[model samples]
Structure formats: C-alpha cells, structure tokens
Target: MKKKHVLRLLAAAVTMGMLAGTASCGNANQKTAQENPLAEEADSAQTEQEHESAEEVDMVFRGGTVITMLSEDDTDNTAVAVKDGEIVYVGDEEGIETYISDATEVIELDGQTLMPGFIDGHIHEPGNMMTEKKELILPEGQADLDVYKKELQSFIDANPDLPIYKASGMDLQAFPDNIADNEWMDELDTDKPVVIADVSSHGNLANKIALEMAGVTKESTPPDGGKIFFDEEGELTGYLSDAVSLLSTLPIIEYTEEDFSSAMKEFQELANSYGLTAIDSGGTIYETEDPNQYEVLSNMHSAGDLTLRINTTSWAGQPLEGKESDRLIKLLDDSQKYTSDFLQICQVKFSLDGVPEGATSALLEPYTKEAGQEEGYAGTQKATEEDLTAFVTAMNAAGYSVETHAMGDASVQRSMNAFEAASEANGGTPDGVINKIAHVNLLTTEDMTRMADEGVIAAMQPLWFYYDPFFSAQEESNLGKERFEQEYHIRDMIDEGIIITGSNDYPVTADFAPLHAIEAGATQQSPYEGEDDDPAYIRNPEQSATVYEMLQMYTVNAAYGAHMDDIVGTVEEGKKADFVILGDNPLTCDVKAISDITVEYTISDGRIVYQK
Candidate 1:
C-alpha cells in the first residue's frame, strides 16, 4: 500500500478502535444484588464500611507499571487495588492505601513491567505436549545428526525403559547429503526404534526399527496429500510427510490426567506470567464417544476451573456423527446458546494446507525441486471446489462464522470462492459478522482486494515472517521482483479497510509472545536488532504502525475477530474487566522497547487470577 494511504487508513482504524472495547461472572445459584449488600453496591461508601470491619483486602500490587492495554489515557501506575478476587481500581499508590487495611497482601514488584496478558491466537497445546512427550529432540542451532545421535545415546543410557525414542524438529535445508543424507536413519540403532519429527511438523524421518513399529515398509504406498521419501536406488530415505500420517502411526507416551493437568497448570502459569489473561484457544466444540482437547476444556468450564476465557472453533466440514453439514448446524445451534463466559464456541476452524517449509503450503507456484506434483504445482489443495462450496453453503445456512487456514494464494482463492458462495447463500451483505482467513501468508494484492470487498477478516500471524527461512529464499529465487513485493503485504491489507489482527500460531514458531507479536506487527521487523544485520537476505519489513494500532490488534479488533465486540477486548463500562497491569506505559517507552514489557497483574472477568 502507499505511505499516504497507510497513514490515512490507520487514522480511520484508530478512530474505529476508540469506539470498540473485556471481564465477570456470578456464581451459579448465588443470590442477586437485591439480597446481598456487597453485590448490591460497589461504591466508595461500601469501601469505607469494608475498611471498618475488614482486616484488609486479599491482594495489593504495589508500585509497578500497570499497562491496561486500553486507551492512551489509562494509567501505568504505582499500584492496583484488588478485593475478593477482582481489581477494584487502578491508580496511584497513596490513593489505594484505604483498601490496604490489615488483611491486604501487598506485593512489591521492583520495576517489572506488567501489561495485559498475552493472547496466542493459534496454538496447539496438545502439539506442544508432543515436544516433552515422546521425548522429541530438536536440532541444536546449526547442528546435525551427530547432535541427535549424541543426545539419543545419552537418553538411552539414562532411561532404557522408555519404549520408543521418537524425536522431532529437524531442518532439511541445513543438512547436506555429505553430512546427513535423507537416509541417515540407517546409522541409528535399529533394535531400539527411533523416529525424528521435522520442525515444520509436516514431515518425519524414522529408523528401520521405528518404521517396522509403525507398520510401514519400503513398498508401502503413500496416502493422498502425504509422501514417503525414497533414495535414487528406490530405498526408504526415512522421510514421511503430513502430520496426520505420522501422528496416526507414531508410537505414543501416554500421560495420566494428573500429568496432563500438571502440564496445563504450568502452561497456564506461563501465560499469566507473560500477561495473558484470556485466550481464544482456537479449537471448537462438538462432542461424541471420541472427544479431543476441546472436550477437556469444556469439562474445565463445567468444573469452574477454566481460569482463562477461551473461545474455541468448531471443526467445519470435518465429519461429526453424520455429515459436515450436520456438524455446522449443531455448532450454530449451540454456538451462542452455551452458558459460562469461561469457555465459548462461536468460530469454525478449517485447515486448508501445510507449512511453507515442506513446500506444501498451497502456493501459487511449486518450489524449485519439490518431490511430487506437476513440475510447478506448489502444494496439495485440501478440498475440491464442490466440497468447499457445499461446506460454506451449509455454514451460511446455519448462520455460522468460519475461520479457514489460508496460507498460499491458491488456498486463499478457494477460501474467497467459498466466502462468495456463502455470501450468495445469505442473499445479502452480513455486517458485524467477521469471517476470518487465519494465517494468510503470501497473499497477493488480489487477495486483499477480495477480502475488503467481501468483508473477510484477515486474521494474520506476523511471527511467520520470523520463523520460516522462506523470506530470504523467496526474495532471491521464487517470487521474482514484482510478486515478492506483495508478500505479507499487511500495510496494504489495512489500507484497504480489511480488519487485521495478530496471532502467535504457537507450537509452530514458539512465538507465543503477544507483545513481541505486536512489536513485529508495528515495526514489521524482527524483535532482535541483529535480525536484520545480514546483507544478502534481509527479512522484508512492512510499514511501521503507531502504538495505537498495535494495541487494537489484541484489543478492540481481537474482540471483533472473536465476534465478542460487545463483551470484551477493551475496558469500557459494561465490558468485562479483562486488562493487565504493566511495569511501564507502552506509550511512554521507546517503541523499540515495547516488547520488553512485563506483567505484574492479570485480570480476567474482573478476577485477579495472577499477580506478581
């Protein structure tokens, strides 16, 4: 987009953001305010009465930066007053002393920055678990199979009882045939099975023993959208593509509920430590004899232990019970019809393609020497137009919002067509309802124009630019000059009046840092200074945004993406009090240092679930 256009559009976006806004819940069967005085009034007089009889407030966060992540006007102050579990007020230290009677547990945070909790838009907690579980080993920086062999030898020496030695996170481009060819698995101990999962999660390499355990052989036929690598001599090269292929066959290390709960607890704590009060877990709800992680989250909601506000996605076009169409109807019927603000299901997530690393991202053109496909086919398409159109038509009939994973232009094109079909099915324009295209990487100008005209939300992840090596590769080879400029053209998307929000897509990039994501979005540069030092292939950066625009991605605009604009994402009156206390005001700090922000307190649904 043009610089003048960028500034003008941001001006409008900022103005629109000011008008949009997050926290609270009553206990089930709890008496109403008419019967209970504390519930009846939350005024200064009630504070005085409570002070007279009260020992002190439950918790007091004293003297630290408090970034509400709301207005340019909200204070980054000395302290915050919290009572019963909710933040009563946020202001100066001396002003909050009245609530600091005897029972107040005052915490002194020495100069730590506290902002609103981070929101990881697209993460796989289960996938994250795979790292620790199955003992998956990742490559040390610039290191190769020798590193893997050494780590594995040590692991086997330490714990021979662990059945399988499954590892993940290997890089193909980094390894050459001389050092470690595709068939390097033969060097490993065949008796003690091992499988190496690629960092991309798109492929894996397995030893002979592991292959036998997975019941695959050299003669095994590859599934549609999946491949097994073979050497020039027609030998098994130990490589396997497509996650569903590997995960379905890979050996597992089972965990008890306690173990799973422990991991989740740590995950939750980490989120709070980083100032993530609420998250759209980005998984959907549809139940059966067979249930996924979303079902576990639902149970947590039922037990009132779902501490974070998670809005999940329903699997659209993924068969549940009868047909994809039926699932969409059920999801719509139960969408807004569920109680409990802690857990919600409103959006539907559809996977369209694989990652860029494996050249399986459904790009407009194929990579240099990809194994399969017509000489120039980029990647496999997930659904035929008929299937896609039918699904979108059914979704529209059910009046449900859909979130499709559109990475490449071709997949993006299919998503647009489906959106058009869904829109046509609707018979008229549907306003305030934002249907998002998640992880829209490498979108062309045509993609953004269509999104704007069709009102399709571009829920993009800035982290991808930093994670994938393609930014450099594409600049040199694939994109050529003209199309290369269109890569991750976020500034243009915003200028076109398409609502853009940031996502982490965690467990993919290990980039669950929301502030860092914002910094990347605002600066359109990597968080680290030296990230751009290289002369040969600098990551193409986008236009810089004012601090206001960054905040909206997580706030106002985020709420809009989740279809919860009326409820949260800001601190307006009547909006849920889901705000964070930062160590310094982001506005006052240098833009370069915003990513270093710390969180002293995190409030969700007006409850103080975490405090430093």
Candidate 2:
C-alpha cells in the first residue's frame, strides 16, 4: 500500500501572531508566497529553469476519503495538495507523490474523512462570547416559578457585585399564562436591575429597577415592532417582546477593540472546533451599540488573523421607509469601506417578524386558541409589505442581497413577495447577490416553489428541525398540531430545488455543531443523547434529508449562499485549502451516530487551526 503523506514546507519560517492577548485564529504555519522571501525566490528561480522533479507543495494529504463536495458522483479523488493557501492538486494516491519533496510536511490522515470545512450560513459572531461573559444561563425546561426563583437567586447571590443581574435561557412557557412579571424578579433583587431573557432571546422579563431605569410606565406605548405586556388592570407586567426587549437597561459592558478582537479569536477557535472555516455573521456585526465590532474584524483581516471567512451584514432597522431606507442604503454604502477578501459587508438584514413561540410571527391564519389570543389574531407583521418590497428592491438594485428573519408562513410569503418585487424591479437578483430568509420554520408549499423561482436561499436551522422537550411543546401549542407538523419542510424544499443552507443560529441554538445539525437534518429528530426511537420524537420525518444533502447544506450550498462559492466549499484545485478531517465518515456511519463522529482536524488556508 502507498504510504499516506501530506506535504508541508519545512524551510519557511512560520510565524504566528498573537492579537489582543489571545493567539490569533490564523494558521500557525500560514505563509503566502508573497509574504515569504524564500517562497518568492523559489518561484523566481523555478521560472528560470525546468524542474527535475515535481514542484514541492506546502502541504499534502493522501490517506483519507476526500469528499470534494464538487460533485456527488465524483469520488475517485483521495489526495489533495496545498501550496500558498490554495489547493494545488487533487487526485489519487499515486498522483500525489509527484508533488512530494524533502521539505514537505506530510500529514497522514489515517483513514479519516476529509471534506470542505463547514460554513454556517447564518450565525451571530461574538454572541457566544457575550452569552458566556454577560448572561447567567438558567436551567432549561424548568417551568416552575420556584425553580426559576431559586436559579435567579443563586445567580444573583454568586455575582453580588454586578451592577445589574442578567440571566438567559428562561422558558417563556414556564411562566404563568406564558408571561412573567416584575414581582418575582423584584422579590429576588429590588435594588439592582434584574433582566432575564427567554430561551428564544425574543423576550425579556425585567424587574422594577430595570424598568424604571429604562423609563417604562404603564401608560407608555410599545415601540413599533415591539410588545409591552400589561396585566388585567393595565399594570405593567415587565415582560417586553421583540423590539421592546431592547428597552431593558442591561448594563452594556464597555468592550474595547482589543476585547472584541480577543472575543473574535475565541469565537473562531470554537467555530473551527466544530469544523467551520467560513460563516455569515447573521447581522450581529452592526447590531450592537459598540462601534468597534467592524473595526476589530477589519483589523484582524489586515493582520492576517482571521482564520474564518466571514460574510457580515448590517442591520437594516424596522419600518424601512423613505428617510430610513435612504439611511440604510447609506449604511450599506459606508460598510463597503470595511470589505476585504475575508470580511465582506454586501448584505443587509431585516427582522420582518418574530418567532411563533412568542406568538409574534405574522401568519395569514389565526393562531390556535392555546396561544392565549383573541379570535383573528394572526400575529404581528412587524414590517409593512409595502416597506419590505420597496427596501428589498432598493437593496437588490444597489447590488446587495437582503436577509430577512421570517419564521411564520405569512412572513415567508411576504419575504418571497419582496424578493419577487426586487427581481422585477432590478431585472433580477444581481450577480453575486443571493437574497436569504433565515429560520424558515414555517414555509408554504406554494412559496417554496416561489422561493426556487425567485432564487431565494433558505437559511435554515437544522437544530430546530427536531422535537426537543422545551421548545417543541411551545411551538406545538402556539402553531397547533397541523401547522407545527408542517414546519421545516427540508426534504420538500430540496425536492423543489430551493437552495437550502444550514445554520445553528449560535448562542440562540444550544448546539452549534454542524455534524449534530447534519444528523438532525437527515433524521428530522433530536440528535441528543438518550433520545429514544419513539415515533413522537421525530418531527416531519418524511421531510428528512439524506446525509449527503445535509453535508451540501453546510458546505457548497452555504458557500454559495454567502457568495464565497467561487473560492471555497470544494477541494478542487485552485480553491482555498480549507478542510475538515473527521474520524468517521458521516455518510457511512449509522444515521443516528453522525453527530458522535469526531472532528479530528480542521485546516484553513493551508494551515492546521484545530486538532483533536
């Protein structure tokens, strides 16, 4: 048998840079031909004479099942060679030796599965960091008020010096009548402001101090695209939903450029550990009050510290009309200054509706009685159809794609209408621009066909495809059994030729692992441990996708959605050398066991960023 060898350049001095008190996510041995004097001289010398042997590459992998992601039928290639951060060769084991050299660092894959590094089409950057640093996580699935009080008390007790107490992962359904009041939180801490966010992050429960700090009164009206719950006597319940939740004066920790930079490094490491080398920021870059987020990302790109290719989006605020639309356009144009090969700002995001679990997502039909709504309550549309259409058209005309957060069927329909209007107004979606709708949890069959017709991309969260304990009940209760069963039609949408890209919606989603999502997408069932074979555990099993399709959702399909398909997403020659090596092939493993497969190695731009 031919010895498996991965080539690496040993002669070049590899320098790793530390940024913001943390090791940068860039490949430790990353060196481009332009950056290395030796490599440049070698190239110059090679141009002057015919080489006696094949050209020496920077790195090579020859002993793995290379899933190139270029074609489903093509599987003969089993070796890949990298030079100067680009794939130089892709062929069988016998053909790889030609690129081998004494200076090459050979990486033996040891029969692992090599494939393109995963791309999360939608994720919140530094969100995981914020959750880790700021929010005290409450126990999931506890509906009892005492249980929450105990947890909140413990959290408050542990962090006595905090100016404001903050906790997340509160299940809204756990509260009475699915609403929380300030009384309980005030019982815990009346002096200091206390704010607790629901598991969905779409709602917040604040105590009296926090509400007073935000200047919330019973007479105050809810802001546009927001909801302020009131009790039977019209007293403030202190439960804010959607845009109103932003009113909570949760103390914003002043994060500096260095802090954001370090947080980004940590985020990259975590993403790489999950086999992701590229991601779409999902509109987190400009959502925060801190101005240094974009600057930090730009600085990282300039310093070659970015290991992941990030496609960033600006938050196009609600009610995009007239002056606001013009302002958003200017924001988009100004964002171009931060654009780079690794960091792109070519998309704008809109929150067209809230989630169904909150009964705020727009729907054509009325929500079930269980949602505690009067008759004919179909939820809030948030953005007017006219405004959405106009904004989408303008953005598309300006050569920027739009990503809308639309969870309900009505929201999905409205989004499709906007995209359709954009196509008509702009002639078509501009080249390199792919309009996306995130968290397409409830899509109509007709709109699925329309999505394919309009070339709209579905930014889906496979983690939500399963029947989880906490969320599943809430979703079912809110959406009713029939509509709940219709949610996340993955296989149906794929069959309709709609381009589906996978995402974890990280920080919001407990599991950010693509492998876990792959299994969930393929099975339409929970990929968690102890999940039984009970039929009820499966959610729309007929809508389950195959493992290969799931892989494409995270690889080529996601890359295409992010407009990075031309450079990454495949192991083809001339593509960037971004790859993930797995201890077991997801395709060959038992469908339920795919999530258990270990990520052995992750390489980005020809350098190893993760090893396990």
Maximum-lDDT candidate:
2
Clash number by candidate, in order:
29, 8
Could you give me the TM-score of model 2 versus the true structure?
0.88
Q: Pick by TM-score: which candidate is best?
A: 2
Q: RMSD in angstroms, candidate 1?
A: 7.2
Minimal lDDT window, size 10, model 1: 1-10
Candidate 2 clash pair list: 6-60, 6-106, 6-107, 7-59, 7-60, 8-58, 8-104, 8-105
> What is the model-wide C-alpha lDDT for candidate 1?
0.57
Alpha-carbon shift of residue 12 in model 2 (angstroms): 42
For all candidates in order, the CA lDDT equals 0.57, 0.74
Candidate 2 residue lDDT tens string, 1-612: 001000000000001110001111111123222244654455635733422355899898988888987567667788888999998777778778878888787889888889999999888886757555655877655666788889878777877877877777777666666666777765684378887777677778888888888888877766555677778778888888785545635565444566667778888999999999999778662234323566778888888889999887777765578665677667767666776668776777888887777777888799998876678888777778888999888877777778998888899999998889878888876665678888877878899899877778788888777776556787789888988788777777877877788887866775678888888788887777777366666777888888888888888777767767666777876678999999998888899999889999899989899999
**lDDT for 597 (candidate 1):** 71
